[model samples]
Target: MLRKIYIILVHTIRVLAKKVGLLSLLESRRDRQSLLYVRSLFSIYDVDDMVQLDLPWWTFAAAAYVENFLRSKNGEANVFEYGPGASTVWLAKRARQVAFVEHDGDFAAVLRRLTEGVYNVSGVLIPPEINPRQALVAPSGRVGYENCDFENYVAAIRDAGGPFDMIVIDGRARNACLKEAVKHVKPNGIILFDNSRRERYRLAIEQVGFSPLRFPGLAPALPYLEETTILTRGGT
Candidate 1:
């Protein structure tokens, strides 16, 4: 009971700090690294438009890392994302092909519109359904992976020409998505899981046996710090 209360208090404080601009002030005091990163994002996209549209872009640090890494790779590398949004635009700019699966039909339409002129991007909608009895449960008792339509979710991507060079698991049933991703990703490909600080996901990732490189820090447009982990087969 006390631990839960402490957690709630900490979250509330963070929210308050972000709302009052204290978080931004603190970040500035620490360094201009994050600020510079945000500026770089503006070179590729309009911040106001993205914020208004509510698209999911990686945190500033994560975005910079991914952008740099993808630029260094072959231009023909294909990418698959479990969730589609701003990251789709970001990936499309750097990769040869970008495909994403969204669980919301309305949002999928929005994604299509957003990427309309971008020839190499495609979005597929696979709405989720509830399942009461979960077959798998993590040690932390988080049941996100077991209560969704993950089989069809994975199938949609496979049908869309998978075996992608990069996969991002930032949407629903993430653990289940990761399970499927491992089978579909090219041997040298990488899997990026955002908000990886959650204990349940950490435990789930441990079972995957991939060497993880974690980036823990502030993200663009979000209030607090989070971790985005990069996992590759045999640490490639």
Candidate 2:
């Protein structure tokens, strides 16, 4: 609540200052867009903070990537999303089938609540003690979750029964995130990797054997741009 107020106050001051032609004038288009995005974020919070079920830049970036892909692909396409970050629930809404895997128990609980009643979304809490492979063993009558390393697990998912039509990777584990994604996607399937600019995820994608398509430019009022990379499927 208070954070929203603070952002509003800051925005008002900046606007007035800009009008007076002072106080960090918005010289660059990037800066101008930031202010607008900040305002948009705060406004949603003011009206109903719950309007933001997911976190900021990451959530926005992730949603933008997937929405860009699935909004056109119409069909019962299988989507494998790693990491139950704030955006997982939103991804579920767009994909035909979505399975969310989370390493954190607490974060998983919160996400579970947010995802409740969201059709076609299933939440899995990755147990800590067990290895990533065993832990991933799909639950009783539920999908088995292998408590293996993320990369190996993703590869296994593909080799196991993958060749998915679309794969969205947003987890923080970037090194392995994109690599595993390639293994799962079917030829010609689209893969959207969030935060391409983050911690060298772009470079990571390059090493993973997929071609990434960069955006023309960042849109106005968007939190961050230089981070999203779209990879369209080509021949194997």
Candidate with maximal lDDT: 1
Best by TM-score: 1
* lDDT (C-alpha) at residue 52 in model 1: 38
State the lDDT of candidate 1 residue by residue for 98-196, as single tens digits: 988888787787787778789998778876655636543311124553454455665577777878889998877777788878888888888889888
Error of 1 at 106 (Å): 1.9
Clash count, predicted structure 1:
1
RMSD of 1: 6.8
TM-score of each: 0.73, 0.60
- What's the lDDT for all of these models? 0.70, 0.54
Candidate 1 C-alpha error for residue 167, in Å: 0.3
Model 2 lDDT on a 0 to 1 scale: 0.54
* Candidate 2 lDDT tens digits, 146-167: 3334433333344334567776
lDDT for position 230 in model 2:
68
